[model samples]
Target chain A: MNIRTIITGLLLLTALICPALAAKELSGQEILDKSQKLNEADSRAASMEMKLIDKDGEVSKREVRFWSKGEDKRLIKFLSPADVKGVGFLILNADSDDEMMYLYLPAFKKIRRISGSAKSGSFMGSDFSYDEIGSTGYNDDYKAERLDDENGQFKLKLSRKDKSDAEYEQLIMWVSQEAFVPTRVEMYKEKKRSGKAYLELRKVMTAEKITKTGKYWMPFSITMEDVKKGHKTVLTMSNVKVDDDVPDDYFTQRYLQR
Target chain B: MKRDKPILCLCLLLSLGLILSLAAPTLAAASINGEIKLDERAYADGSSNQISWNRAEFKLKVASELSGQAAGYAELKLRTADGPDVSSLADLASKSKVSAYSLELREAYIDIFGFPLSNLDIRAGKQRIAWGTADKLNPTDNLNPYDFTDFLDFGEKIPTNAMKLTGYFDNTTLTLASLPVFTPAAMPSTFDSSINGYINAYLPAGMTLVSSESQLTLPNATLGNSMYALKLARTIWGQDISISYFKGYDSVPNLSNLTLTAVSATQMASALTMTYPEIQVLGYDLAGSFNDIGYWLEVASFTPDQADQTVISPAGTTTTEVGQYTKYTVGWDYTFTYDIYVNQQWMHGFFDERGSTLSDFLITRIEKKVMDDDVLLALNWLAEYNNGVVGNMFGPKVSFYPADATEIELGGFNITGAAGSTLSTWANLDQVYLRFKYSF
Candidate 1:
């Protein structure tokens, strides 16, 4: 064959394959958006049991009922553990830049407003922080970039867009290629990783009892471990109902007292 | 007749409780839940030792849909506590041997939601209402009375027969309440006799102090004696703001109609009558947060019909007059870590007249949780320093939860003060207390 003819044929073959490879590759932002959409629901009611394990291997359990409407409104009521029963927490994300949070203690029979700066505090002495549970969407607060593709999974690095808004400066997420679910996440206090991930989420257990309701994929169980603190929190959800009719008044302080 | 009144009421409540329990199944949803607490205290001076089943309370709540778009809610609480002197009728009525226990109705309230208007809610019955931004010591909370017989039981507020109507706007709420029956604060009948003797020593010659008694006079249940209040609350600029106005009889009575009579040559009788007088109060409260600190401020101005005063004569005759005053409190709270929290507050009282004897107080509280929150340790301290006399109280407690449904708290309270200080009167009562609670 002639050299000119072979070169032309090789160029045509490369052009055909490049478009297909590009079609399969997705940006980090696209993966996160897909994952968030799968998790969001119109209304949700769930009974959850949280098991907190410390470094000494001692475990304390708390049972609570949680309800959420849209991305901004959420309510949590402790149902078990006599000392903390009937304690309620409400979070309302306003259309503006601020958020409102209140805590109701049955012992005092009063509802107290919690400060916004408490978002970085631990959530009920668990491994998760209040900001972690309060997070709804990452697209608005974080900028994501694709890091690597390995073992049928996509690795994404997310850094906070507004430095002051979040406690963690950056997060590394490992997402599944097939389901777009996040298999693991690593949190960091700095924007750049020096040698190894600072706070790695070593073990992640997804829900085996998820139910696909409408266009959403619901998970009923999740476990997160704080490697630096040697702490773990296992959250198991049950009796979950989605898209049910929820009264708007349930999000008010009056309902919190009730 | 007075001793039998509580027994008769107890019988009526028992019948009512039976009827309600029988009919609870027919309601849309009904729940019966409560807790039982047992307490014991050992005094440092060994003057008094108290061991009692502090509280046995049961609450019933029922909800049903009424006509149109209205919903009805009814809640009732039955409580029983051990009284002093088991042989006394009051004590027997509270803990009957035959019927196992006599029950007192603590709350019987009916709430109507989604009333005629979509944004209005109404509640009427015997209920406890609290309003303020400050923690624990709320100057704006005057609608309910408190029982101070057990100084350690600080969170309990006596329920009153009242009607409360709240109207909601876009982001604000307006509440109007009418309290029909007046309830006065309950205080211990007996105090330290040494303090009384000390006061008598300061009296003029030949005016010896024999004994003193305080009597409470409650306003009769009448239309003219009713109390009313109005409150407006809103969240503005990331702050919760509220203003309230109350026209009512003071819960704490003033010493009125003081009489001193000579019983013998070297002994005299002194009688002090406590009377509740009509008063008006204007209160304001604000709560917000900056960074990690949550802060609150509450202020109230009380205007009485007459100023309060005390006049002493060489002949042992004493007179008192009641007055206007202002009270304010500012507090802040912060959580240092996952399991550590701290709170501090300063309270000030200012009377319109000079030499009012009111002292400013500072309180601090620290709490820590360990063993994955299964164990909690707390320390609380209060110091009164503005006045000439310095009084202080320190409390340290540790609580453990062996199970989810039970808790035990071990604590000690130490109070100290100058001879004439307010806390010195109770210095003999300093004690270590243990509490056990079970919930269902």
Candidate 2:
């Protein structure tokens, strides 16, 4: 063959090998790990507003303040809606095998323990389930596989390593490569995509490079749609602060009464 | 004397309000919020149909950053009802009488946190102290009195003048409270005429029932008559457990002295006296969850001081006796798919005079969201079985939220039971009610 023919063949080979090399560089599991790190911090505090909309476009609003330390403890207090103000919820991930939750209602003036079987139940009557909001990290519970790449975004399919431990059988995530954050996620009841719920993260905010950890991206707005029920919930977060020092007693049951 | 008590109470309440308002500006961060509720109920029997319009309330709260650990709160309610005297504007002046319904201080308390220790809190005021794990029927709950005039509103607890202290540990808490005043349950006056008629019909041959009066003997307002309570609560292995001790007077009065005076061949005057006896109670409660079901058990043993009951017979003979009792309750609740909740409870009363008796009840509540979460439709049914008598009350309500600050509720309650049963006494009192509330 002439030199021109050899050059054409080399060009074709390089074009095919470059994408394979890039694919091998980061597996889906590694991408998920990096995304989690970029999204979560050691401690966080935020004031959030939740808007619930029905199929007919009716809306109701709720306000809450949230605090979380590490990956295990979280506290949420209702701040608005006179009937439900002063209601609190506390969650503690004690060990890998178990989790503890408590609820405080102002009318009852008592703290009550919640059962683990409610993981699949709605969170505060919202479209999001308890497990969805209580999840610490996805890597520990799911086995990930790279699906495809489109428009500078990587798509991954995750299957629960143990089916009994999770509410959803499968989840598909579309992650943005630039910010290392998941832009959209679809949850399936079965292994296939017959019954699915959709979640979208919008209006992401990133911290400036003033902190030692540099810039970190967080979703300021999130929408969860229950396709079967034709219901949707939008959560808008404001006044968010990361790496703030949370009191050690904030996770206790007594704090719920405060 | 009876008519003057309410006026005196109102004057005292108004003076207290003025003082609190004058002192509010001196605090650090003060806020106020409350609701105005208007309720109208139309009874099927038309015996006690009424409309209450002036049910306004405001809660004032103040916190001081100077001490960084002190806060004060007070809630005042102003209420009035339109009586059945006026039907039109022509009778509005002379025929109509406007009276104050209730001017109540629901809560007036000062809370001091981090007192004496890092995790200790003390509250002294006229406040409500709710205890126990059961839903509405708590044998271990004795700190507050109840307003039984409206049986459907069992959740309302009357606040008492008290001093409370709570100490917190890692997973446990200890609470102690002293209630210096005795408050009795407010009973409905609907039973007065019925009880008088029954007593007259059962009288002996030589005696005819004249006017009968029932008097309540309340304990003297003294420090020795004050109530004291202690509770220890802890969480272990995901279960909440508590032990409680209470020394107080029974909120319910028992029939004691019966005297027949002014006796003649065809007429006799009857006087029945009711007394609240002091009692001591030891209680234990436990609550836990299994899967989606929640369960609780509350047990209380009561030892009351021997109370003498004197009965004067038509033959001019007198007899006396004494009485005592114990109570227990077990309850469970579960939520089904579609947000249907079911609660079941069993209560037993061991009376020294009447022996042991058991009562079973089940409450089913179903809620549906319409118009997003803005409108909610709730249906509640309470079925009770006591003393081989079955009774049920079904309430279906629809609440609409025009805005975040306003709620309108339309509801109806139907009560039914067999004759001679407890529920049958108010069988004709089924009502359709509408409530409009606005909060700020």
Model 2 per-residue lDDT at A39: 69
Output the worst ten-in-a-row residue range by lDDT, candidate 2 chain B. B349-358
Interface RMSD of each: 2.5, 2.8
Native RMSD of candidate 2 (Å): 6.3
Scored by TM-score, the top model is 1
Please state the error at residue B298 of candidate 1 in Å.
0.6
Residue-by-residue lDDT tens digits, candidate 2, A1-258: 999999999999999888657655888998888888876788878898888777878787878898888888888898777766778988887324546778888556667666565555666567876666635478777888888786768888888787346656677887777667777777776432456654432212112222223256767777888776677888887888878788868898767876
Query: Chain A in model 2: its TM-score?
Result: 0.80
User: Each predicted complex: what DockQ?
Assistant: 0.42, 0.34
Model 1 chain B — which ten-residue stretch has the worst lDDT?
Answer: B349-358
Which lDDT value does model 2 have at B53? 28
Q: Write the per-residue lDDT of candidate 1 for residues A102-148, one digit (tens) a residue.
A: 99985565789887666666677677766666354676677889986
